[model samples]
Target: MKLKQLILFCILIHIVSFTNALLRRCFQCRSRGELGSCKDPFRFNATEVEDEHGLATTPCASGWCGKVIEGGGTYSADDFDMAIQRMCVQRGPDDNEDRCAYTVYNSRKVFMCFCQGDLCNAGSSFTASKSMFVILTSLLYLYSRWNQY
Candidate 1:
């Protein structure tokens, strides 16, 4: 009777641990940033202005051209424009010295955006590892139980 109870308890513990791990993975994947962090790159301030030459073809011209602040990563006209539309000042355009000009802001906020992107990528790998761990653990547990019987 004691052996039977012990087996049941072990099984229950394994189930609980596996379930908790799965829940964590699900929550991490659904969260905004990745791995329990904020993914937003910038706090945009919108400004309305009228273009005198009617040459405001890009949205960033009059709406919100991300405040070039210190600490933010480098910025190119293209990626900067896209980030502006997304209300995020995180993304920067590809580096090109000859054609497009780029500026690197010395701001923590800008750096944070780059850091967040890195974290997001790391989180994806972490989640994958968690999945594999769970599968292997479950298989090992089952195999052990069968061998014991």
Candidate 2:
């Protein structure tokens, strides 16, 4: 009976460790800016009217930018937009012509839309924060289970 229990405990520890490693890898992938670059010069399709003088204002597009892996991956820009929307209210004027720009950083990978921009941005920070949360949660769960043993 003791041997059986030991085996079970060992198995549980292995499982937890494996899961933790996997989660950490995923977190690193998202946080390290390894995936891509920011799409630069993200322009608005239409000119906007100024609030007071009716002058043409510099058009801007409200969108999240992040890095994506090369040779295709499961990540989607729409999913990133949804996640961002969940976190914060949309910025800028509500214009249909406004666009969100995404840049894939890998030299080998080609993104269908959005021009290349600097990788430094709010989205990268958000990604790192989220990944840290996931890693911490996984660790907490493992710690709890270990204590129960």
- The candidate that wins on TM-score is 1
| Model 1 misplaced regions, further than 4 Å | 1-38, 41-71, 74-125
RMSD of each: 16.6, 17.9
Q: What are the per-residue Cα lDDT tens digits for candidate 2 across 1-149?
A: 56756766686678656643432111001211221222222211112222323112221233322223233336653333211111111342245332344543335433322211121122333343455468667756875686676
Q: What local distance difference test score does each model get?
A: 0.32, 0.32
lDDT of 1 by residue, 95-121 (tens): 411122234444323321111121122
- Candidate 1, 75: how far from true, in Å? 11
TM-scores for all predictions: 0.24, 0.21
lDDT of 2: 0.32
Give the number of colliding residue pairs in candidate 1: 7
